[model samples]
Structure formats: C-alpha cells, structure tokens
Target: MNKPKYGPPHHSASPRYTGLRTYMKLPNVNDPHELNDADIAIVGLPFDTAASYRSGARFGPAGIREISMLLRPANAFHKINPFDYCSVIDFGDLPLIPGHIHDSYDVMKEAYRQFAKHNVVPIGLGGDHSVTLGELRGLAEVYGPLSLVHFDAHGDTWDNYWGKKYTHGTPFRRAAEEQIIDPNSSIQIGLRGTVYSPDDMDAAKEMGFQILTAEEARELAPKQLSEAIRSRVGNKPVFLTFDIDFFDPAYAPGTGTPEPGGFTSVEGLSFVRHLPLVNYVGFDLVEVLPALDQSEITAQLGAAIVYEFITIMALKNRDGKT
Candidate 1:
C-alpha cells in the first residue's frame, strides 16, 4: 500500500538522545527507491579491512551517527537551516562483506550508485580511507572523471602496501590509475609526517596531484587556504573526501594512523564552509576509530564535519547556487 516516508522526523519535541541513533536523527530509509526525492542521503560504510594499522574504524559510522544526534537543524555560522532547505535521510549502513576488500568495494560501489542515480548527494560515514575508492567508482559512473579535494595527513597515493594494491594506503593511486578522478584538477591538502621515502611526495606529484603539506597549510591564513582549494577544483564535479586524521591527534585521536602535525578543528571547518561554491557530487569523512578515541572527541568532530558538509549543501540549495 503506502510508500514509506523519507528524511528526518521532527525531533524538536523529543530529547536528542531519545531515538534510534541516526545521522542528525534523520529517518532511516532502508529501501533505495524511497530516496528519490531526498536532497542528501547519509550512508554508513562499516568496512575497515584495508587499514594498515588499527582495525576499529569499522565502528566509525556508528560512532559518528551516535554523536550526530546532538546536531541541530540550523547552522549558526552559515545562517541556514539544512532541513528547511532540503530533505536528508539516513540510508543505514551498507552490508559490506568484512575481510574481503574487493568484495567490499563492489558492494560499496553499487550502494553509492543508487544514490547517484537518484541525484542525491551521499555523505558517507567511513570505515577507512580505502572506502573512498569505491565511492569514487560509483560517482564516476554518474559523473565521469570527478575532481578530487582530499583532506588528510597522508597523501594516500602510495602505489601499494606489501604488494597489495587495495590497502587504505593506496586508494587514491588506484583512483588515479583507473581515471576515476582527474588528477590535474585534484589537490591533496594537509599531507605530513614521515613517508617511505622522499619519493613518496614525488610519486604524488608525478600523479599530477598538487600536494600541500600540513606545514604549508599552517603558513597560510584560513581564507587563503580555502581560496587555494576552491581555485584548484574550479567548478568540476568534485568528490570531497576528508580523513579524520586530517585534524591534529589532540582533536581527532581515534584514527587508524595518527599523524602528529595536522589542522585544528576550526581550520578544518573553515575549509568545508568555503566549499559550497564547488559542484560537489559526493562526500565522505573517514578513519574515525572510536576504540582509540578519548571522550569520543574524534566521533564528535566526525559528526561536526558531516554537519558542515550538509550545511554547505543547504546553503547552495537556498541560494540556488548549485
């Protein structure tokens, strides 16, 4: 008989912690066909088999969703209420086959494909950086050769790890090789810490990705850094991928690979706020391993990051900019 409703439930009368843990307390729309009218679909990807270090990021999506219940409808900084402008829903987690990277990727790609087909922007709560490759594949089918705006503490463009090509360490390299992302238009921000060799940076450079080390980002004003990123991607259909480790360990300690030097939470938010001008096709916030986190700060930050992304979408829709 009747079709199921989509988007969030009105929770103003209910306490934030009183409902099922969904992103922004949105309604859980289990069926893909129900997502047709939604402006944004939130999906949890709980696969971390490709992690090189810690394995607990498989809980990242749930962690972020639990924390996201505290998120309000309005964004004070942007002066827009996301729900007032667009419909957003939690699509629940993709049923990933754990311990099998390729199979997981196949599943992720197909899940994202449904969102793309419906013209819904997918904000993925990640399992790890490797999950991004699958997301890129799905979006590429809808919008070919996306421009990439990558925020992370590592380049993630290593050719392989222990001869395995699908590790979290090599997702972007795979994306580049597959031509899923247009490297000339893509840029990597917040790269820092030790690498296998100096050639690590060289490899990313050779791949045509403009690299901005954490040190370099620190040197620029927030506005300047945001401007630099916006100029590079420049109106291309961009897939914005943020690894939680992009923030300093003090702010986001629950990542698989904790890099020492990274951006502050405010700085990270500034970059995301500046991105509403871009034609974003998809977004993901990855690598939040709650088992390693203290006081759930990493999960809190992860939820906030997704909040800003949705705020951007709301602002764009309100202004008729996208």
Candidate 2:
C-alpha cells in the first residue's frame, strides 16, 4: 500500500502527549497556499462571546486538541484509514476578538472563504454554535446556499437575544435571513426542552426547516433518522453543525446551554456514521466548555465526532463521490 501523504505520526515513533497539541497530531499549516495538496483542514474557531449562558467555550478548541491525541488514524467501522485516503492538517485556531461578535464574524468569514477557495474541507472545533454563521457565510460564497444538518437540543432560531441578532442562539435564523443556508433543504434534529413560546420550534418549521424533537428522535432508529435526514436534504451541498449539547447533560455536561433527555455517545456516533453521503462542503462541532467538563469526556466525545466527520469524507473520497 502507498503511504499517506499527510497524517499523524505513528504513536510508536512519537509520544501522544509530547508536542504542541493539534487535532490527531496532524501537521499545522496556516498558509492557504500550502493547502493546495490537502483534502481536509481541521481548524479551531475559539470565540465564545456570543454564548448567552456560561462562557469559557473560547478554550474549547484547545481542550478538544489536548484530548484528540488519543485518536488513531483508522476508522474501524467505516473500514477505511482516513489518513490513507486523504491529506489532512490541523490549521490551528482562527483569529477572533474577545467580546466582539461582528468583527470576529468578518475575520472568520474571510478565513473560511480562503479555505473554500482552496477546495479544502474545513472541520471547525467551535467556540460556540454562533461561530457556524461565519463558516456558512464564507462557504456559501463558494458553494451557494447549503443544506443544513443541525443537531442540537435547542432550535437556535430565535430572531434575537436581548435585541441582539448574532448570539449563539440565533445563527441559523441569521443564516436563513442572509440566504447562506437553504432552509427548504435543511433539517434540525434533537430539539427538546422548554422554550420561550410554542412558536419556537414552529418558527423553524415556518421557515421551511424540518425539525425532529428529542422525543421524536428517540422514537426512530439511527438508520431511520438518517433516512429522514437524507430524504429532506436530497442532493444539496450540505454543511453539518453539531452542538455537543445534542447529547444529554449527563453525557456532555461541558456545554454552555445543555438540556436533558438527549442521545447517548454511542447513539450520537451511530447517527453520524449512518449519514447519507451527499455533497458535504463543511462541518462544525460546537459548545464544548472544558471547565464544566467532567474528566474531559465531553471533549473526547467531541474529538471522536470530528473523527467521524473525517471518516465520512474519506469514505466519500474512496467511493469517488468527491
């Protein structure tokens, strides 16, 4: 077998905990020109100012990286070594301004726009769920409006928070308003918990999003859920955003606004694994606050989910779908 062009060094050759932390210990390449040969770029967007509840998710990127060293290169369930199929790198954290959302959004959008120009798929380790809006802005410039596959315990479609339009709870609504994501082709899963009004979930439906509440999701098997998601988002450029809080607070307590009655780690992973291979442009996993994390279990699970995202891309590449 031919050796992989880029990947983490074997654990036997280099100790896991010995170096500057990067996702899976992959090489760090910050220059966009250098991305020409890379297939995937794992980036950290460490801006949590938009978080309305507990802060400190600004450190989420570092937390995920610190624990990501434990991940291996191969994906057993997908039956393909991801690194063998594609060259992936840790692009390091994107720049962000503390307590400044609009400026940070501009910076983040431009950075992602550059990556999109290079055709390198970015997997963002997020600062908060709101960071996804910047990612979508950049990517939509290149891919047009994208289909959204959102997993979270909250609808996150509120028009505004305290008269502010750009909080973590309102990115999707803004994404819809800005025409960055095509709501007609989008689907939100795992929405549960009390809301300000009954119209909260209904509002998303009114905007053309297909939502499956946490209760509704529990009724369907993982395969069944994936089928429902595929049927809703048929043949569109997809951008998947997962809030760590999509799982129960018992499993992912490190998030800012975690709710109960969610999926288990196995169940969450299974749902992602069964996702129908479509035109995927980008992905992000958000809301991991290490300070609240118990034993970094949430971070570890976040890393594993990102790994699954890479595995999916590798599978797509192997099948000549990209």
Every model's TM-score: 0.96, 0.97
Residue pairs whose backbone atoms clash in candidate 2: none
Across 1-322, the per-residue lDDT of candidate 2 in tens digits comes to: 3554678887798777787799988999888889888888999999999999999899999999999988877888987888888789999998899888889889888988988899889999989998999999999999899999999999899999899999999999999999999999999999999899978888899999999998899888988998998888888889999999999999999999989888999889999999888888899999999999999999999999999999988888888774
Position 95, candidate 1: lDDT: 91
- Determine which window of 10 residues in candidate 1 has minimal summed lDDT: 1-10
Q: Local distance difference test, per candidate?
A: 0.88, 0.91
**Native-referenced Cα lDDT, model 2:** 0.91
Give candidate 1's total backbone clashes: 0
The parts of candidate 1 lying over 4 Å away from their true place are 1-7
